[model samples]
Target: MTTGTSKAGMMMELSHDSTLRELTTDQGVLRYHEAGDGQPLLMLHGSGPGVTGWRNFRGNLARFSEHFRCLVLEFPGFGVSDPADGHPMATATDAVGRFLDGLGLHQVDVIGNSMGGFVGTRFALDNPDRVRRLVTIGGMGRNFYSPGPGEGINLLMEFTENPTRERLVQWLYSMVYDPAMVTEELIEERWAQATEPDTLAAARRMYGKAAFAATAAAAARSEEAPLWAMLHGLRAKTLITWGRDDRVSPVDMSIVPMRTIPDVELHLFPNCGHWVMIEQKAAWESTVLAFLTRKDAA
Candidate 1:
C-alpha cells in the first residue's frame, strides 16, 4: 500500500493488496482492479472530471464481490488508465469492449454509473451477445438540459485547486438529501484521491477536452439518441437505479426507458443523489444482488 501525504498534505490510504493489471487494447493499456470470484461483473465509473472506478464503486465492492467476480475499470485518462487517441466518450465504449474481451469474458453483468452507464448501454447495443445483464445508475446519453454556469463553474474550480475536506462534504451533501451521511472519512478519502498528482492532471485533461463538451452538447440535442435507441435494443435484463434527489442527471430520465423496455426494472432511492451506491450502499447492494441472482437462476 502506498501511503504518504499528497501535494495538498492530505494523508492517502490506497489499497495495499489491490492488484493493478493492464489490458492491451487497440487504444492503449487499460488499467483495472479485480476482486473475488464467480460470475463476472464489470463496474464502470461516472463522468466526473476526476472520476475513476475507485471513486464510484469503493463502498459497494465487498458486497458485490461476495456474489460475483467484480472487475472495476479506470476509464481512459482517469486513474491509472492510459488516454485514448480520439474523443474521450467515443473511444470509451470500444476500449471497454476490448478490455472485456481481453479478460476472456464472453458475457458478463455490467454495472455502470453516470457516464459509465451511458457507455455500458452503448456497448450492449453494439455487442449484445457479450453482455448478460445491465444496470445503470443515474446514466447520461440523453437529451437533457446541460449544466448551468453554476455547475460548470464549480467543476472548473475543482480542476484547479485540491478539493478541501469541507468542499467534498458540501459536494456530497448537495448530492444526497441526507447531509449526515457525508462522513468525515469519506470526505478525507475523496480529497486524498482528488489531490493526488496523477489524478489531478488526469482530471484537468478531461476538463480541458473540447471534445467532451461538444459530445455532451451534441448528446443533449436529440430525442432518439444513441442511448435511447440502445436501450430499446438491449436484450439483457436491465436495472435502472436512480437517486431521487439527483440534480446532475435527474430521476426523470429513467421514466421513458423504464416504460418502454419490457425487461427493465427501475428503482428510486429516496434521500440520495448522484452517488447512490456510495450514499446508500446497503440498499443498492441488496437490490443488485437480488437482481443478479434471480437472473442467474432463470
Candidate 2:
C-alpha cells in the first residue's frame, strides 16, 4: 500500500525477470517479485547477506513460471523490505504465514533454501493445511549430524574475519564443486550487497536476535529439540535436497529427516555446495520442475 523507499531501505527498482511490488501487513510492508499465472509457488530465500527473493530466484523463475505462479519474497528485515517496526524479528516460519496472509494466499506450494529451507520445514509442521507441498535445500532447522572434514565450513569464518573480495571469492568457491562456477560478476554483485548499509544493519539485528539463534542451535540437536520433535507434524509430501559438499548446513543433517519424516525423500548432489540451484542449474531446475508437476510420489 505504501510506495516510498530509501537508498538503504526499500528497493528502488525491479530486476529484469519480475515485477517488484509491495504489500501491506499488520507486521510491516513486504517487498516481493511476481511472475507467471498458475498455482502459487512461494519461493523463500536463505539468510545470506543481501539476499532478496529476486537475487536468489532470478535464475529459476523463468523456467518455473512456465507451470507455476512464482511469488519470491524478501522477508521483513532482509533486502528492501521494511524492518519489523516495534515487533521483534520474525522467524522465516512465522513471516511466511503473515506474508501469505497479506496476499490472501491460504495455500501454496512452498520452496526454500538454506535458512529458507529451515523456515519452510517448520511452517509445514505448524500449518499443514496451508502448504500444498514442501521443498527444502540445505535446510537448517534440523540438527547437524556427523560433521565431516571438507564442507568448506571455514569459508564463512574466513569471510567474517576479513570481508574482503578475495575472502568472499574463496567462500563462494566453497559453495560449489568447481572454482570456475563462481563468476566475477556474481562475486561483485554479492560483495556489494553483503557490504551495503541496509544489509549490514539487518544482519546485526537478525543474527543477534535470540529467537533466530535458538532455532539454529535447536536444529543442531538430533534429539529432544523442537525442530526434530515436530517432524511427524509435517503433513505435506516433502522433498529435501542438499549439496553433498554443503559445509554450512552439512549433508549429514539430511540423515535425521530421512529416518523420521513420514512422507519425505532426500536428493543429494555431488560437487555442489550450499546453493543447489546455482551449482547444479540444469539438474536442479529439471528435478524441481518434475517434482512439482508429478502427482504421485513414485
Candidate 3:
C-alpha cells in the first residue's frame, strides 16, 4: 500500500501507479485501491456484470482522495477479488465487515453504489457505532411504485444467462440517460471481463434466471425483515443520491429511506440513470464533498 505524506508525493504516486493493494481477511484476500490520507472513507461498487471498484468509482476517487483516505473495496466473487462461499449478497456484506476489521478501521464514512449501498446500509444497521456518515447512490431502498427487477436488471440478467456483446451493450445503454456513454472501448473492456470463465460463472450465480428465482424464493421463506424496514435503525448521517431516470433501481426506491432514516438527505439528479456518479460526475462529487465536509447543524 502507498501513502501520500505530501500533496506532490500523493499526486506522483497516483499518477504513476494504478496497482491495487490486498488485505487478508477470513472471507479471503480482499483487494482494494487506496489513496489520500485523512478520515477513512470506504467506497463500494455495484454488483453488475464485470463491475469492479475502479470501474464504478475511478472518476470520483481523485477528488474524494483530496479530502479523505478513500478505499474502494473489491467485493468477493467480482473477479478482482478472491471469491467467497455463500450467496453473493451475504458474502459481500460479510466481506465489508472483514475488510474494515482487517484494516483496523473501527469507524468510517461510506459511499456505496447499488448493491454496495445495500451492503453498507446493512453493515451500518448491524453495527451502528462504526459508521459516521453514509452515502448511497440508487438501489438502496424497496420498490414502491415500479415493478421489482427493473428494466436494466432484466437486461443484466439476460446478459449473465447468455453472455453476449449485444446484450451487454443493451444493458449498458439502459444504465444511463444517454446511450453515448456506452462507448466501444467500454463495451470491449466489459465484455472481456464479463466473459472470463470464473467471472461469468460468478455472474450466473448472482443474476442468472435460476439464481434470481432461487433468491426470491429464499427471501420469501426468510422470517427476517427486509433492508428497507431496517432503515430507521441506521444511525449514521445519511445522504441518498439517485438518478431521476434510473431504470435499474428506479428513483421511487429512495422513498423508504427518505422517510425513515433519522438523519438523512436525498438528491435527485435529472438526465441521469443508475450510474449517477459517472453520468453526473462533477455535481455528484461537489454535493458529496460538501456533505462530508460540512459541520453538523447545531
For each candidate, what TM-score against the reference? 0.78, 0.82, 0.95
Instruction: Give all candidates' CA lDDT scores.
Output: 0.71, 0.72, 0.89
Q: Which model, 2 or 3, shows the larger lDDT? A: 3
- Candidate with more favorable, higher lDDT: 1 or 3: 3
Q: Candidate 1 at 179: error in angstroms? A: 2.8
Root-mean-square deviation (CA) per prediction:
6.8, 6.6, 2.0
- What are the per-residue Cα lDDT tens digits for candidate 1 across 218-260? 7779675556655667787899998887766766677767876
Model 3 ranges with Cα > 4 A deviation:
1-12
In candidate 3, residue 47 scores what lDDT? 82
TM-score of 2: 0.82
How far in Å is the alpha carbon of 146 misplaced in model 1?
10
Which candidate tops lDDT?
3
CA error at residue 295 for candidate 1, angstroms: 4.4
* lDDT over C-alpha atoms for residue 67 of model 2: 76
lDDT of 2 by residue, 2-52 (tens): 233332222323345337778887767888888666899999888654567
Top of the candidates by TM-score: 3
Residue 244 alpha-carbon offset, candidate 3, angstroms: 0.6
